[model samples]
Target: MSFRLYWPLIVLLLVIPVIILVWQWRRRGRNVVMPFDHGQEGTGFWLRLLLNSAASLPALVLAVVILILSGPTRLKEPEVKRKLTNIEFCVDVSGSMTATMGEGDRYDASMQAIDEFLEARQGDAFGLTFFGNSVMHWVPITTDASAIRQSPPFMRPGRLPSQSFGGTEIGRALLACRKRLIDTESGDRMILLVSDGMSADLGGGRDIEVANKLKGDNIIVYAIHISTGEVPDAIINITSLTGGEAFAAGDVEGLKSIFASIDGMQQAEMERTAADAVDYYQPFAIVGLSLVGLSLVCSLGLRYTPW
Candidate 1:
């Protein structure tokens, strides 16, 4: 906790005079000694005591008000993950992501999301891969987003059936990233594979085997399946089994919202304040006003005149 106004604390010095006055009041004599006297104390002494006690209430309350007015604030720090995220962004260049449902085709939308994802991340290292007939690595794992963006495209690998929308080799692509991401000394490591094809096998030999291996080591595998609709069982299972989420982006709009939620890559949120900080002073001020009013009423009822 910190204070914006350190000077307000000086107001408490006024209490020193009150403290001495209180002592003097406690020792002072009272008025009007009574005739009926088994245990009789003078009125002046008790009046002095009452005044002294009442005086302390307003003083303390004022002191508290001053402190509150000083603008106290507290900063809470977060525990930084011991090992930064070793993230692999594997995308399908398998050719089907090229199929269009909106202004931007599925592949274009995925790449746009990837660009946003890369821009948002803070302290983590990231890498890129594109899988068509075979796995192609765009950038070996690195923290530099600009470097990855400037690098050459993961050139479409040629094999049999070049015209058949590039054979989906998601399994091999994931496997290629496995050793590099897993063997890294980074603490929290993961893979994010994005594709539009249900035709692709996420559970193929390389994927299933590597997924199982990585899970055992606490490495997570996430998949974002983009299409005109729901993702297939193969894509869902790979993400589920490897302890990650599988989300289907219906179109560009839904994809945007999903990517907004997918901002773990973004800079740290330590400075952001809670959305619900209300000014509590209104209630306190009301209570203080009530106390002061009550004090006036009590004085009037007692008729301030000493008998």
Candidate 2:
């Protein structure tokens, strides 16, 4: 509720109206010769005061006009809004992903979990990338979750075109996903890596190299190993270096729980923007209009006559 004048120097013009009002109030009555002097009675004290006030209305109106011209503005309150996050799902489509986890296989459970995750995060942008020996961007980053939701059946491990797509190359897949996330100019970036096997391509410190690249761009990596075995050290290194963690999901329930945990860990952030100044001329305009009306009414009867 704070107010300021954009052109504060223009307020000096108010002195013009102030001087006129003061001179009108201080001057003595003039001695004019009348045709007949029945009684030498002057105007009553209250009536004289009323006349002075009526004359001052024009000066008051002038002051209001000057204030309006000075460009008065008020500070608007700050607003809190949720920060957007861009999530890219990097799912493994190797032949091993077809193995049973719960009632369905690992690939089915992973897609189902991903769908649930999309449901929870309504306003965020999402992308889908499937990787084996090859990398394919199934869906580009978008706020619409329907595209990612409809992607699972087409990219299932067993349904891939050739046996060449059966090998897991975690390092290559991560780099590909990183390239996609880097093109986004705004919001926080993240990659969710879902796989059941270790990558032969990530050995010989290649994991560290990829992790450093992802970290430099402020991209987080969350890995989910959907099997009974321990998660690979290379996967762990990448996730840890990029400010994320690796989870091992033994069954469908465990996988879903892991996704829930990730959701809770990375809750939507709230940010408050600085207050801005907006035009505050309504009050001054209303006052000026009211004074103009009053001045018109006073001119009809409350003015002094020339004798």
Candidate of highest TM-score = 2
Q: Provide the TM-score for each candidate, comma-separated.
A: 0.54, 0.76
lDDT of 2 by residue, 214-266 (tens): 99999999999998999999999999999999999999999999999999988
Per-residue lDDT of candidate 1, residues 122-227 (tens digit): 5678888777656667788877787666543334323224654387766667777786786787446778878777545554454566567767777677877787
Model 1: lowest-lDDT 10 consecutive positions: 265-274
For model 1, how many clashes? 7
Among the numbered candidates, top lDDT falls to: 2
**RMSD to true structure for each model, in Å:** 10.6, 4.2
Sliding window of 10 residues with minimal summed lDDT for model 2 = 1-10
Q: What's the true lDDT of residue 164 in model 1?
A: 42
